[model samples]
Target chain A: MEMDSGERFIVPPVNVRETADQIIVEAEMPGIDKNRLEIMLKEKDLFILGRRAKEEPSMGDPVWQEIPHYDFRRVFALGDHVNRSSIHASFDNGVLTLRIAKAEEAKPKKIEVAFA
Target chain B: MQLIRRNRNTTPDLGGLERLQRELSDFFDWTTSAYPTPFRTFGLLEGAWSPALDLYEDKDSLRVVVELPGLKKDEFEATVHGDTLVIQGERKSESEQKKENFYRVERIYGQFHRAVTLPTPVDASKVKASYKDGVLEVILPKKEETKPKQIPVTIQSE
Candidate 1:
């Protein structure tokens, strides 16, 4: 759902993890459409912004509301060792996943032990 | 090599009451590790998390829309139990295939249960539910008497 940006409220919750080959960043963002999401990569910093689709006001009395609506914004400082060109992103369920591949030289290398 | 890892794992370096809280999580309490705030886990424990819900009655039916992002249709169970509409599901944690270090953690993962007491009696058999883009919408047709009636008045002119 495409929507003109509304008020930015809270930073969506996220879990970031690094591995030998890639760094995975997962953000919990429900009610956000892929068309309204923005991902930016600059230098060594990565920016993620998501906007919750505006709910069309319907005719009816609201019975219950526990979830407050809000947009999502977060920034992460990636290191110079990350491969900028290989970054990948996909959204599923209500979570956004961003995979930042590491530079070739940054991957963990196992040294073979030799006994003479 | 300096390995700088700032992660809030299942077991962190916390002592005293915080440690007690963690233990409570093991028992009946489930504090979504990544939630910035803490849910008291001492008495009756709330499920790991409860998705936000909106229930309303329209002209023809009662509608319910629940927020449960990242969950596949099969991952959640939604049904009307007695007078309550129950939605329950689990948010799986990302796999630890070849993890090195984590920089930040905030998302909460685990099981969740949300039950809303339906206000009006509805036709249980006609309930329809659909899950898309992490949202669940359930529509229940209202009973005959419960529906709003429109009475038209005939013009009485001499």
Candidate 2:
């Protein structure tokens, strides 16, 4: 990819899996701290941002060079069946996992058959 | 003499130190011209990206711990290049079936680079790095110059 000034450095890669009740989103965000991560749901979109604090040297004479030290931002558009109000997220070991349940009315239900 | 003329020409009106600072800053900017744009943006908060590292210092050595989850050990490579310690790694995405439907996707991937400048010079020849349970630990022994020294105090009654 061509390097652009406006482009963000960190773009999280996500995987989406679904079950009968909910959708699971697993995002790989290595080298990111959980405390710096923010997750929010607005309408049918999910926004995720994570920031990593920089480290200052303690002893040696200082040297200068460029390093990455900014917040990571990503947004995802959700589907209509996704129940935004019940969405939940957790960050562990640099990975952000989100659980979004499907609306009750959207789930498949079984019906009993009567013999005539 | 020629030496006095050179000194006068190089020195600024502000002060010798101020002139040197300006010259040094300019040199740094020129040398980093090859850096990518994102690198420059992130460098604005130099040493402010990663949180305060939890350091465990003992008499013999110091251990620094950083949290790096979802990254496999083989995916990361750490090296000491000059005064900078570089951590370069890639988080690959899991393969997906062509027929799979993605309702929502939110994850980050691609190359990641983290360069940490050691507070005190470390014994790069004997450094150790290990990752376990989502944490990366780097052990660096203090160089001879930065090592602590013991000073004895003699008690005298006057």
Candidate lDDT (C-alpha), each: 0.69, 0.58
- Report the lDDT tens digits of candidate 2 across residue range B1-158: 11011001111133546645645664575346432111112222231223223445655566666555677768878787655566666656443333445643323334556666555677889889987535677777778777888979999999
Model 1: docking quality category: acceptable
Provide the lDDT at A35 for model 2: 72
TM-score of each: 0.74, 0.46
Query: Taking the tens digit of each residue's C-alpha lDDT, what string does model 2 give over A38-63?
Result: 88766556777776656633423213
Each candidate's fnat: 0.72, 0.27
Per-residue lDDT of candidate 1, residues B1-158 (tens digit): 11111122232234557757655664442223222222333222332455678877877888888888778767788888767777777767554444357765556556767677788888888999987667788998888888888989999999
Q: What is the lDDT of candidate 1?
A: 0.69
